[model samples]
Target: MIIDNGKLNKQQRKAVETTEGPVLVLSGAGTGKTRVITDRIVYILENNLAQPWQILTLTFTNKAAYKISKEISISDTSFKILNSKELWMGTFHSICLRILRRNFEHIGLKQNFLIFGEDDQKSVLKHVITNLGLDIKEYNPFVWVDKISFEKDKGIQDKYSNKELNFDKIYTAYNAQLARLNGLDFGDLIIKVLELFQIAPDILEKYQKQFKYIMVDEFQDTNAAQMQLLQKLTGNNFNICCVGDDDQSIYS
Candidate 1:
């Protein structure tokens, strides 16, 4: 239920207002991307198509989410009512943090665990290779530790496909380090959630029910981890929409 702003052509109109199933919006610049997103939320609220509780929007950047919020508020204040502190619009990492924070206590966290970005994760890896008796001189931890992040981006753990090993001890030690410190590195966010989902279907089901309309912005840029996450969010009900220029994807 998106407003047919003069900005969207007929095809764009279908992409914007599409109310059911998986949707892929492939378009280039000047194709009214933000305009369509803004109008879509506007249409949903204005037409009463979705209960204020059911429309969940996911954006790639916090800045983008804020902008969408600002634009939608212009149509009516009721738009403010849909803001899901844990469910509505936000970056993948940001939203995952919310979910993790909710369940952190179950995992023995005494407080909200820290969410590390890429730079911080590198430091963790560097420390692990050094502290766990690996020869950094020979290992060149810096050269390959970044792979952890990339692998996590694709939802990969130790890859049998790649056939790299000998770090079982080091890997466990690093995880122990994060656990002792009550922190999570950037890669942990998605990978941890995937683990939690596997172990806790009930928890996953809770989120699935909570986010009624699953919309992903910049979807083509998403990697394997994010692609799996998208599936988890949408469930089998198919109330999902993905908008991105597939040609622009780097992880592909």
Candidate 2:
């Protein structure tokens, strides 16, 4: 095999060789987790198990994604997998951005809508709070931002619940301002994608079929919303490989 995983330990080799069904690798730090994932990807391409586009590799951070992509590309220069344009390798948010760009209209967003950063999000919230005649001291901008993020992560829309600072009102107005600006906050990435998939079955099926094999790095860190998105993507095929160490998991 050109994608030699000979140096991998016994457990890592097993992970690379098991190219069928759902596979989970739970190991401590410095156990060559990334190596096994990259090797498995290369093994799939080399063995003609699936096309590059059919393989979906997800990472938590852009740096890890880039590193994996780089390692795979340089693993073997002769392999055509490097030239495959269908390769889907990126962070969850980045992958969702790509999907949204193509099908944003279904979710009431333009294809070219803006993604607001922390500063812009706070600015928008401040505007909404100010117009509502609420003091920022009582309803701190950071607190409100975190509250909205928490709710969005749970796939819940801000209902006008009666609260001391009227958080519901602020959230509603904040969303209105975002809509007017044609923008979405950071937390909206996963939430919007989940919403899109739930509302549009055809779109979900399209991706589910396109990606035959799904691989997730740092699986333990996945939040509830991310897990929901993964479930939607892996409907029936269930060719998923999750690699992580629960012992080292800082987030659940």
lDDT per prediction? 0.70, 0.84
**Which residue window of length 10 is worst by lDDT in model 1?**
78-87
Q: What lDDT tens digits, residue by residue, belong to model 1 across residues 40-84?
A: 666665666676556677787889888877766555443454443
Question: Clashes in model 1: which pairs?
Answer: none
Judged by whole-model lDDT over C-alpha atoms, candidate 1 comes out at 0.70
Clashing pairs in 2: none
Tens-place lDDT digits, model 2, residues 158-239? 4533454586688789988998999998778888888898899999999999998999999888877788889889999888
Q: Number of clashing residue pairs in every model?
A: 0, 0
Off by over 4 Å in 1: 1-7, 76-87, 156-162, 165-167
